[model samples]
Each structure stands twice: as C-alpha cells, then as structure tokens.
Target: MTQVKLANNQWGYISAVIDEASNEVVSLNVSNHANKQQLATTLSNLQATIPKESMPILHSDQGWQY
Candidate 1:
C-alpha cells in the first residue's frame, strides 16, 4: 500500500497485487481510504483474472487491511 498527496492537499491510497513469477501487476485499486473494503476490492479484481484451479500464495506485511 502507498499514500499519495493530491491537489488541494487531498490524499489517495493505492493497493496492488503483483504476480511474482511474471513480475507483473495483476490487480490494482485506488481510493481515498485505505480500509478493509479497499483491500477486498483489490483481491476481488485479482480473482477475476486468475484461473479457478490456481491457488496463488499471497504475501502481505500483515497490516490491518490484511
């Protein structure tokens, strides 16, 4: 997760999922809040791109959103 400052001093949060083997971004989400919903949406987006039979290992910093 990363935080970015927008114009007028607003903030945006970025959430992303990467494929380790391919070194590619599999999923991404940006929002004003970095909460559970944001994480959920990121994972949900990733789910749509992967094969149903593939069980990919997910690694996180174990932050609150994880």
Candidate 2:
C-alpha cells in the first residue's frame, strides 16, 4: 500500500494494492465533503482495479483513511 496527498485540503485519501502478486492500484480518493453517492464510485474504482486472484496483504501506515 502507498499514500498520495490530494490537491484538495481536508479532502484526502490513501491508495492500497496487492503488491506482491501484481502491482494493483487501490486508490481511496476521499473528501471532507464526500457523500454516500461519491463513496460508491470510489469503492467501485478500487474493487474494479484489484486483481481477483492476487491476495497480497494490504499494508500501510495509520493513515486517516486506512
């Protein structure tokens, strides 16, 4: 897992992935003003990108999003 800061303030996210099996990218793009509608797409993006058989243990710091 890895993290990248968003240009927007108070609005942040952490990206995680199955690194060993594949360089999958799981980006949790979040915002302080995010709502339920936004959440679905964000989660969907992560789910869609992850490799189905790649179960690499997700790792990350104690990020506010993670």
For 19-58, candidate 2 gives per-residue lDDT tens digits of 4445654555544443454455665776777689966454
Question: Please, what are the lDDT tens digits per residue for candidate 1 over residues 33-52?
Answer: 99989999999999999998
TM-score of each: 0.88, 0.38
- Quickly count the clashes in candidate 1: 0
Instruction: Show where candidate 2 strays beyond 4 Å.
Output: 1-30, 33-44
Write down the worst ten-residue block by lDDT for model 1: 57-66
The alpha-carbon root-mean-square deviation between model 2 and the true structure, to one decimal in Å, is 5.1
The lDDT values for all models are 0.92, 0.50
Best by lDDT: 1
